[model samples]
Target: MTRQALVPTTHERGITTLTLDSPANRNALSVSLVEELGRALERYGKDPSVRAVVLTHTGNTFCAGADLKAPAGPYAFVALLRQIAELPKPVLGRVDGHARAGGLGLLGVCDMAFATLSSDFAFSEVRIGVAPALISLPLLPRLDPRAASRYFLTGEVFAGTRAQEIGLLTEAAPDVDVALAPVLEALRRASPQGLAEAKRLLTAGMRDAFDRDAEDLVQRSAALFASAEAREGVTAHLERRDPAWLQ
Candidate 1:
């Protein structure tokens, strides 16, 4: 297979690993990266040899969120998140470190998520004067609305334990390899046809909800991007200072 900045590697055991390789920026999701990811996922979902897919990242952070330095313009990241959520095959998020904002959106899209004990998770878009748009559709159904409201409003960092408690993660392990083993094992034990059918059954009820939420998210996110607070917050972060809006 051809390689790109985002590395897509498949193991003989039918576990495809897609690593977000932009370590310098903590694997921040760029538009090109998301597009490549969408393509890779589409290919894997169609390949009969590929039984399951694992999404991960390199370095100390899983993903820091969208690459704020690169202008997303509009709906770019949101579309990518929807692609992940709608992928036909089983997708597992193997989170080793921190997953914030759009990064957390990736976790939500996964059919299952396994985070390391040391991993941190947060819906931190609020800190940047935006909402967690892409992930909220998946998250709202999994999490209590009250819990979602609290985290989305505060943008506070929470540990893996809290992530599991809030229904954001399947389980927390001591390390990445350990976290991935159970998911791989489960995939191995299930017939591919059965897995697909099961996934469809589970997701059928949420289809309408996801659709409505996606529409709402796009509208609100676009409005937030145009707000003065988003501009100030993003500028302050890029400049390595506190946001004046916070003060």
Candidate 2:
């Protein structure tokens, strides 16, 4: 049997682009998809010809976060976030679509991110009886504390402009590609060593924190996902009903 492919890669002019190709579920982070994304990053990240990597999705939505129905989930997803954060080559995000829950977690790891103003985001985990525990690695550092508190508890969907204002995004464009191109081109012209060293300098403290706290966060996340509250909330969501916790 053929393994279904999730990350398909292309390389040209010192840039490698990995497209998250699963559209059926809005490119959700299934186990295999996370694994494939890790493998793809390792593959291109080590190539001498590659100076940078671009992560983009092929669907209307970038990612829906974890596949709640998967018996085991969002564990390997944490490792994937670490991989993206540590890639010696710069990783730029091309988000032309909405990113939700853990999806925003992955976006937070991008060294630079460009999203379309049309795209919306939410920390929907709270609404479903869990918290964005593991994702807070890359997330909390980039976000304004007041903004983070408001959004984390409310789970409200915010526009790209608001996201940028709160430090979740570097820039928002009317057209995603238009915002992404010049950045990629500028990265392509940069000295590989310069980019690598700068990225390392820029993210050292962040990565140190991720390494220090990731295991604990992952444990917290798994516990939450396995809880009665999460199970009820997720089931209610799938069934299109209000969860019991809601008034």
Candidate 3:
């Protein structure tokens, strides 16, 4: 299927690129976009010619999280994120700009991820009175629990260096293309079977971690979603103002 939300290009060397095309809203994660992304990823995963996948976004921002105006329900967003995480191929996130909330969740799910030196990341959900339910599952394993709690709770933006230091990003390069080149080259050099095996093994190793706390996380998220504070927070953000909770 021809993708409406993104452009998928495959190279002879077996690396597939999925470029986020919805630049108008800073490539916000609309339901359509997430569906398109999931479909494209599923296609690439089934194609033997595709050895690895690279995810990038257009315009100035990598992703600004979910579009407030879009009608993407919470379950849809969470399902799409889970699909990305469960893809068998080695997925690489090439971030050139800002990635926040759900956007940060995308970066966290990738098998390997890199960002531009100028790229910024934040788990700004708490400020909106929502829990980083899906994001925290993948992120907490890669980051220090204390540090993750601090940032997720405070909703503060951090630079790429800090992101790398905290284990959210693997490397910070001068630019997205530069950061991606090495990963692509490495993928090309590695055995596809080996790569897939390693990915499966690592994911299996992390299953216990996820299972242990997934229930509590889901409950926390559900409670946050039902709270008056969350409604007020999302409303205030859509109105481009401070939330009542902040006051």
Candidate 4:
């Protein structure tokens, strides 16, 4: 059987849309998906006609987190996040479904994000015995400390409005496309050089955080994922039973 394209591309006017097409696993970040997404971003990043890149997905779950069965390496995921942050053109996110665990990292990396009010989000790494280490590179600088603390530690789900209130989303309305229309128009109207400079100023701190802490966090993430506790947690999750610690 032929392999299907995991990340598909579409362009309209000056905007490029990259859809996460692996709905079979709720669009989890697998190695192939990450690679394809990086390539797409690189291609659009260099295209002057592509004023902005929109990252969206094709399922009820925008991204269910790391693909447990075939998760991408920590370094690769970090690189993908960095690419979004460093892209010359603005990267926008349109989320109309659920985002959990590492998936939330995508929203944080976007220059701006819009979601439907009914969409939900969560930072679920804790339940699986790992910290949200790599994702914090983009999220920590943007998220409200108090809100981050609550969700990060508790692993609770929050609606798009709460996500927006905590800085994870730019806007959450009844319709994501409606919310994004004006922003897309503004992006199309803005000068390319102007947008690049503005994005540089906006994302400098995040890029610095990546440089300062990404390696250490990657090591930390690898260590955690390899631990006995994490193994048990993951196994239990897959088995649909409570982890040992909860007993």
The candidate maximizing lDDT is 4
Worst 10 residues of 1 by lDDT: 3-12
For model 3, which pairs clash?
Answer: none
Poorly placed runs, candidate 3 (over 4 Å): 1-4, 7-12, 208-219
Residues 1-247, model 1: lDDT tens digits = 8555675565758788888887878888777677778788888888888788898888988888878876454477766666666666788988888888878877887889998888998888888888887667677788877889899999988999889998899898788687678669879778889878888877764566666676777788889977999999898888988988765
> Can you give the lDDT of residue 15 in candidate 2?
88
Ten contiguous residues minimizing lDDT sum, candidate 2: 67-76
Error of 1 at 114 (Å): 0.5
Residue 230 displacement in candidate 3 (angstroms): 1.2
Quote the lDDT for 77 in model 4.
99
Which should have the higher lDDT, number 1 or number 4? 4
Q: Candidate 1: global Cα-lDDT?
A: 0.80
lDDT, candidate 2, 85-112, per-residue tens: 8888999888887899988998898998
Residue 113, candidate 3: alpha-carbon lDDT: 86
lDDT of each prediction vs. the true structure?
Answer: 0.80, 0.87, 0.79, 0.94
Model 3: per-residue Cα lDDT over 1-247, one tens digit each: 9545355455658898889888888888887788788888889988877789888888888888877678456666666666666677888888888888888888887888898888898888887888788677777778877778789888888998888888888898787677678778888888778888888887774555456765666667768867898889889988999887665
Model 2 clash pairs are none
Pairs that collide in candidate 1 are none
